[model samples]
Target: MAVASSDGEYEDDPESYHSGDSEEYQMDHRPWLERTAVKRDIQDLYTVKGLYNPSLGLYRYRVVDRLGEGTFSSVYLAYDSLHNLHNNVYWLPEETKSPVGNLCVETGHQVALKKILVTSSPERVENELSILENLRGCRNVSPLVTAFRDDDQVIIVLPFHACDDFRYFYRLMDPPKIRAYMTCLLRALKDIHARGIIHRDVKPANFLFDYESGHGVLVDFGLAERYQSPREATCQHEPATRSHLHGQRCRTDDTLTVEQAVYDARKRSRAGEGKVGFRQEDARPAVKTNRAGTRGFRAPEVLFKCPDQTVAIDVWSAGVILLSILSHKFPVFNSSDDVEALMEIAALFGRNSMQRCAMLHNRTFISNVPTLDEPPESLASLILRLNPHLYTPHQPDPTPEEALEHILAVDCALDLCAKLLHVDSTRRITAAQALRHRFLGNAEDDGPDEQLDPTEGKCGLLHRWVDGQRG
Candidate 1:
């Protein structure tokens, strides 16, 4: 539990801003001269800081401090001053409202006001808002409170989720806690994927988790987009059906399947006809598609420049998070660029598998590293090497049954990890399927009791603030 703050400037005490002696209270019911003075005070605090000008929705929200700043937007912690006056009703466009109306906002509700920068295109801003509206009421997904625009500066209001930093508890989380974390994340992904949405960015930073209460919310849909299949082209090859890229066990004799053998024979025949090399006279254009995602967490297909990327790419990124938890590493793949990222993946899955993966996208992969020629290491071996304490008992003398149970739990987690990290996009586990995985099937029973609503009272915020100090 941690109260959301930026640079220790976010004030959690509502009285500090709403006291009877303060200008805000006097402005509510006072003489014209006094009200004008209060308005000037508000303008000096908000407009002068460049958070929100008086012409925007400044009358409804009072800016406190900045929460975070990203490439496309800056988030500020603010209080909804009009929520109490409106009887806890949330203001939304008529077409955007549900049958029961938008989610209610309490009096003095804390919210994260995300101001989209002018550099972002109008289409991009609209797309992000449209996606958020469609995903309203989805469990574990942050709900949009409201949005306002004034010329180029736009503010999208979202609930301020109080949670601990991932870096503070990633290594400290036990197996059961990890299960709960993945379960919440996958549930959010399942809801969005069912609607054909692809969360291009699915890293830990985008997922806020209150580890003590076992609650989490997926936020920041800026990079999200609907999946659209590309039209079939003559130059594009059909996806490989029996590639070793999925990490399936091979036969002891190293015999190839009939379909693979026939495919290889056809390739050799084409090579004999001098059709393998590049043609100077060819007129075909290069394939290009959206490649918007964070590095290291990107899927192999994304690195391979696959034109028909799908929701499976998000699943791969989730697998990277799982790998980090298992290995006690924040970033399992710390590559600087796409080329280096692909090379890092090759070092784990090996070069032959990488080549077959490239064939899926009608591309070729070449690596000069000698070690990549060998078979890939098993996930269990990698995890054990990184975190041997997972299998070893901490006490001086532990019972046999205790050790066996620990080993079994680790095995279950590794199995799920293997399916998630599968290189073939078609074979990668879906978020829905992952929810049923053995490792996370008992997540509800394993985690802490369900937490109270974060916006109920000052208790939630105070509790989180204490947790933050302790952390």
Candidate 2:
């Protein structure tokens, strides 16, 4: 029997930052940057050279700020001189943080540049690069516009998408605009899955919305995969009534539901020890090697716990993303390691074994991993709750449902959430089914929301300075 353990850099419990209604917002308890020092060198490459495209006829561009950073690379906001004097944005290396910040504002185009570390194994970099390269176009997926090569590093260029991944926006919005979050991303994911691709990492941080365009564009295709290495799924027999995000008043002092409180108790129940359901079946095939993806979002099939796991994995993560957005970005489940990941999933959804999943074979799955002994009911319940103020659940008209109707709506949303989170591998919904989910599908298509693009015309950060622009 093989024993899989965490690399130790990860935390056992998720760091809860910014309880929105209060002063604490945007605290960095767990930082992805500190874990990787080599990323600094990756940024150095941008200093010597930058993205060059003959079509733009650009010579020089300047960067403004950083978008986000991770173990392998960091994306920056920059601009290309050739793009023009309007809003231009570009992605630069993190090393360029100092130089780029010092740069004079030449243009106003904002571009998202990805910097890949040289020390990273070539194979790993290739996987990330391939994921991005394959996701070009397809509306829902971020388009890879171009690429730049230095002596050692590989730089990827994507349009400057809005910074509000679902989670980040949830915190910024007052009360919250929940339904919009689900509808927009669901549409985008539908487009992506239709094109034979799976966005393995379906967290809020990976999506961006152009309020101006009123279109939520999915970004961060780093962990995406081609249609071939996909998942298999089927519709589950679930309760019809669930929560709907229509209209809800927001207040400063809101408390968790009985379900929500129970959920918290459940997670607290598992401290120090991991392994909710790290069965030997999930011990990974003897032949397969290489691990990718964040702990909480990883699918059971990826862990080899369920051999037939498919796109439903993305659906499961998407469900978590939806709940996180509704709860102001608190991850539905925080598993810093592989064993903890299984436990988190199994506890909430129940654990399953690969051998058992295979039994369904040509038939539908009617099973899952065993539930954690004495699992806290509140953990999944509270974690399952979605505030309509944020998500705005789907409804017939969404104008009126009376008080009971309102309560029914909340229950409906949580119910659908539970279905998506079903521990049984076969029971979970796929991104495609999620698009047609009762919560998201019931509402009439809001069609092309009319909001200003938070990232309008800001693709390169090289736009001409307003009058006397800063240098």
Candidate 3:
């Protein structure tokens, strides 16, 4: 199984290839194999060779254009022939509380394939596949078409999709298009939550357009996990500033800036900070530590005391995305680490940490939170520190309907973000609650016009691992 060139020329198998050990998480997707077997017949004719890298094994792919880039993956335009790679999709079994989106399935059509770079453990890549496999039927969520050990490189196949990705969409979208896209994306989120999972990574880049031409597709579940269990949240890898930059590592030769630290802290928060869980809830388990997340999107809880929060953290990130699209600017809270992220959040929303507030209330708000990295008074000057231009007051406060619509979206999203990204898991908004928001409700009844078969079984293997406890 090596796919040759566009010339349709078959090439010899590369003699020397690395033997990749099957990851335990990947093994967990074994259940999917059984369930997916029924899908082979329908998808057999859809197979094709993938465009990127060490070709080998039972993999269908195609060569297309480049889609996007990131620290860990390279997405491209390609075709997945077998499995109706572009035309069909599936969701969880009816019994599950979660709602998954339509998987990418093209009947000899183009699709987007994200090739993850091999920088971390092989298991990490496997974990992403395992997660995607479980979420196969999740509408808008990218499906894991197939995973193969391509010599030294590991590859996962997905359907070709449109470029209305949120990150870049802002650069090109019109008002009507943005609204329509947001409506579709939010609907996807609603369906996703119905299945008991939390899309931990909900940013512009991760979210692409839906199959409905300009519509959006909710993607990038690498950081996503089910909220049914306690998760180990941390800030070890997190930087400590509020600038929109990558989090800084302690070992780096370059000095870490305050901005970088904030960015890293926010990311760490997404790594499982601001979380809480019960023993029986075997979905996500817990331990507090450090983790870094995309800047601006890092929630207040995670930034201040990561590895100590839960699903609310994702809400914060979602709000940032919503705001960015509405404002057409990079998210305002972009920070380099946790401390600064928290400071920015506090500045915007008023300094009201559940942990600190508990002291005044003499009752539990957020009983278990990470130690604060800054002082209480830092909140007042938080906005001022970040704002170097002083106050350039707008006399009329521009109210373009499109901008106002975005403002409406952001304000609504912010309330949800604040609730879901709360420091205390007890106070956070659950997935069920989020689905009911006005913004999320924008596209509720309007399912995709395309008739996609619902998913087959429960895609909870990875959810059980990342969101909850392992056996």
Candidate 4:
């Protein structure tokens, strides 16, 4: 099938075009003349013209075009011939009312084929597979259709969602539309965390949204890990350091009850009929690995080298995404390194507040990093300065004087951002809590409006810093 262009023009049939034979059809194709030692291995795989005249066993994919490329893999837009056939067939009895047994409806449709080189890290591959398996058939998340291994290659198939990155939509959509997209992202995060998994990477590029439906899906779980809930973790005395993580990975949960609970939870998740059943019950410490995350979005805990990182890291990144949209800056903080990132955050909250956050996690603040001499400005004031339109009332309103209401709305959004973007990991808002925030709309009940202090935060030290600045 030919992909339709934005102007409604159809491209040539994918099956008819051969790589290298025509220069016009070449994207991922490498000419035979340019082959080298390291390039020879991938030359044949990446140079192929769809699945025509080739063997892919039970799986068959007709390549449409190259979607993207990374160090270990190349993603292509393809039509899955095998899965499409399966999608038309009913796997279970028609009498069954629940749609849980039906194979994913997206089976035979266009998919994103991520082909990873065999020589890549197996641990990274396994981590992604495990998390995808755990989150199978989940809504608001990109579903993994199927995966198969070929000689020196691994292909993972996923549903092809027609959408653009968060950056594209944020510039085009209004505030309400942006809020809806963020809500969908938060919904996805809720399910991920409930399943005891943490998506260590959450950024604009990872979130894809369809403009018509106002729907967003979280993608790329390569940096994620299976978390041991603090409630169930037995190793409370363990330090959150790289060395301690090595020791924790060696330790195992020996309790049979813990295993059974996890099994039951997973079974329910697979069924997809009831609410997410995975809950914290075991006493295993948080897993630790190499420090990995995007530069600007990395949480202070991660920046300070804390090993026992939790879902809060993702919350911080989500907050950053929101801030970007509000401030009209695609990347609100464009920093060269960790030190620069810290300085960008410090400019808003002041160095005293940042130091208190480092102390909370038992991480040392670098002595060489410079701090601002002036007191920190509140988040609300900063946002107002960057986005004056947020406080501007719409034209032709019932009452001419509605600036107070608009100001309140801006404050509400700033309050939510402050909660999620806290330097102290423990003080960060959970995905569930964020859903109930006033900014998102309080639908459940009509309660008195609570006042949120502009400089107040979850950390006592931050409060002290705020007080000291005032004094």
Candidate 5:
């Protein structure tokens, strides 16, 4: 974990800040002397010979403002002084030259600086860098402009988009705008998953969207991991007979559904965890590792401690995102822990569905909490109760036909949300498949999105200021 604050120095063994929202931690809660000392330390980093000195490394950055703080990292907005000169030319390699791109960055250009303590494990840092490098050319994914070390900190530079996260815009956005945002996100997921990478975190805060471009990019690869490719997963299910190895079929009894086979392969590949794998006549299921992910958005399998979990976890998180939009609630669930999260889910889905989810994970849902006899509210009923405006007409004195249209639109959205929030990971809609849902429309493409050129156009902060650069 990082020992640094957004606007000050991080305490080495500071009290846990996980009690509230990561972005909304209050500095006033600390002792006055301690707070002043940390502030001084942060200011020291901005000095001439300091970590954030305006003339360091390949680029010079003038610290602008602290953005936010997380459990282990802090973000800041900084003006890149080297890239702030509008018409200054800089030499580039022949291969890096782009005909229409600017040699110099536009004036007053800004970027988001995500800084972490260098003391963290090297593998953790390397994993993030490697993943970002692999995803460098992706259009719908957040681009890492550059990274550098300063004293005991590692700073990652990212594009500074002057827009709020998807949570803020979900309510105000119309159906078309929502469709465009979903298209960008799904395209990002598709590109990364095809490369055998799973973005374990897929909440709204990790997705930033430009209202003008209608573009959203998936960020925060901290929890990401590499996994077996689809082809590799398929090969694990092949018959092991010598004749079958030589291209001769052995038995029809070996057949398994794609989902079953994939899980079996995952269990085997991750068998190192313990004596756990696909259940046969005698062997038991694998015990999952510690919990990983946000409280509300975590999938049921994750809550049930399924070690053989797959990309379906991300799909489940995305489903929660959609549910929030439909319900007009930024956070659909705010459970204190995994157990509470499951209980909250059980409220919406009914206890029977949650029990089925537990069964799929080869676990028992034997909780002291009594199961309700009457089923909880239906998806449509819940959405209607939370956001009645969706079912009501916009005009004060509306015609009967106009109101009917509003009700139908809400129903369609509810239907899509239900499919996404399914407890069965095997039955969940994938990012690609979700794009085909009626709510998102027929166009599966995201159209033209903001792309980062490694050489000239490094960040959207520069691209947005270049004026007609994308043209």
Candidate 6:
């Protein structure tokens, strides 16, 4: 690591050192060798310090602080010393433009340094890098600055963004603010999903939102993978179509309904159909699939271990975030395992919906929970139940006009939430569709409203919404 002087100049040679304003020079007036020895010791001290606040990529990046850490990688807040010294900004690639007309601009000197641990396989690291490179300049998506590897440790540099913690402000946010947050997130997903990438992990922590600026950046591609089509999985020779691959439904879609699926599952259980003896062991191996994501945010398909996971999983995770905002809860689903997670979903969506969801993926869902057997609770009812303050008129209550606006906003948000969190992955709203939903202020037939600003360019509507909420 290189050391800098008090004036912030890199000292490459001790011979060139000049104590222009040092009282130490007058006190000691030591010989050149003695002075050099002292300077060398100081440099050694800095080198030791660098072990903790390490520089990377041949001392181009200087660590400022540790941002976060996880099982696979650690992130550091770093200063791009090279860019800072050169007074240059990192520009997006010419071909890397947002497909949905969102803005993409140059990044500043500060960056986040993601250090992938040796525990991760080389293939996984390569895949993550590839996805980031492909997603450059996508709206609201974190673009890659650069990446390098020194031996077994790999470091990826990304533009650093300042944002509030989701837990701190979720309860305080109004419906309009939630709209801005989801708009940014869904825009990011739209861009990534367009490229056939699935962000397996989509949680609040991965999205950095600065309420003051009303801008958010979606980060972390460690668990991201390319979407594998169900058609390709079963029949490789068939050419893939956009509709068939993007949100492919299971074969049971035509035959199964929530009511019928639930009834059949219960009837089979009562008749002991497909029940196997405890001693009847088979030599078949258990089916396995990638089920990578945060505990509460994983979609039903992921929990059901569906082999044909698609980009819909990301939308489901985003829905969970929206659910959190509406219900005034940071984590609406708190489960230790997949089974518990499914039960939590069933509790809200009803076992009937869960059964239909299971059948969609060629699986059976049977639950003994009496409460879940009841009809699914409407999202509007659930939101009001969890957050009664939204509906109750209290002190400082708004006028009739204001109250109506609030109700309408909440209704649109709940409708979008329902669409995004649909039990069937194939039927869930796509990121592009979510952006155009009335909740995000882009209804297909409706003309531009006050939410849009003509001068803000193609994404003016979204930009205005964000700007309007800025503190």
Q: Rate the local accuracy (lDDT) of all candidates.
A: 0.67, 0.49, 0.47, 0.61, 0.60, 0.69
Candidate 1: list runs displaced more than 4 Å: 1-45, 48-58, 85-107, 231-285, 392-403, 442-471
* Residues 117-232 of candidate 6: C-alpha lDDT, one tens digit per residue: 78999999999998888776578888887777766767787877879999998887787788889988988987777566788999999999998767888999999987644323
Give Cα distance to truth, residue 288, candidate 3, Å. 5.0
TM-score, candidate number 4? 0.67
Predicted structure with the largest TM-score when compared to the true one: 6
TM-score of each: 0.70, 0.58, 0.54, 0.67, 0.67, 0.74
Residue 345 lDDT in model 6? Answer: 92
**Which candidate model has the greater TM-score, 2 or 3?**
2
- In model 4, what is the error at residue 58, expressed in angstroms? 10
Pairs of colliding residues, candidate 4:
84-108, 232-282, 232-283, 234-283
Stretch of 10 with least lDDT, candidate 4: 241-250
lDDT of 4 by residue, 1-471 (tens): 343344434444454333344332224454544323223223344443333223433225655456666666777776565653465222222332244432345443466878876677888887787688777644588877767665556677777676866656675555467568778788788666655567888997788888787877888887878654232233212222111221122123533443455455446544665553223685655446446778889887777666456677888899998888777777888888877787787787776677666555443343333445354477777876887776665444625446666567667777888898877665577776787788775463233323224243311121222212320
Return the number of clashes found in candidate 6.
0
Off by over 4 Å in 3: 1-60, 81-108, 165-179, 194-196, 210-214, 226-292, 306-308, 353-425, 439-471
| Number of clashes recorded per candidate | 0, 70, 106, 4, 2, 0
The local lDDT score (0 to 100) that residue 456 gets in candidate 2 is 38
Summarize candidate 1's per-residue lDDT along 249-301 as a digit string, tens digits. 22322133433644664576445754444468988777677789998899988
Worst 10 residues of 5 by lDDT: 239-248
lDDT of 5 by residue, 217-267 (tens): 888887787542221112112211111111112123323443355455446
Candidate 6 pairs with clashing backbones: none
Query: What value of lDDT does candidate 4 attain over all alpha carbons?
Result: 0.61
**How do all the candidates rank in terms of lDDT, highest first?**
6, 1, 4, 5, 2, 3
Q: Show model 4 residue runs off by greater than 4 Å.
A: 1-59, 87-108, 229-289, 366-375, 393-408, 441-471
lDDT of 1: 0.67
Residue-level lDDT of model 2, residues 144-249, one tens digit each, is: 6667666777777777665444444555442124445666677666555544446677776676765444456677666655433211121111111111111111
lDDT of 3 at 440: 58
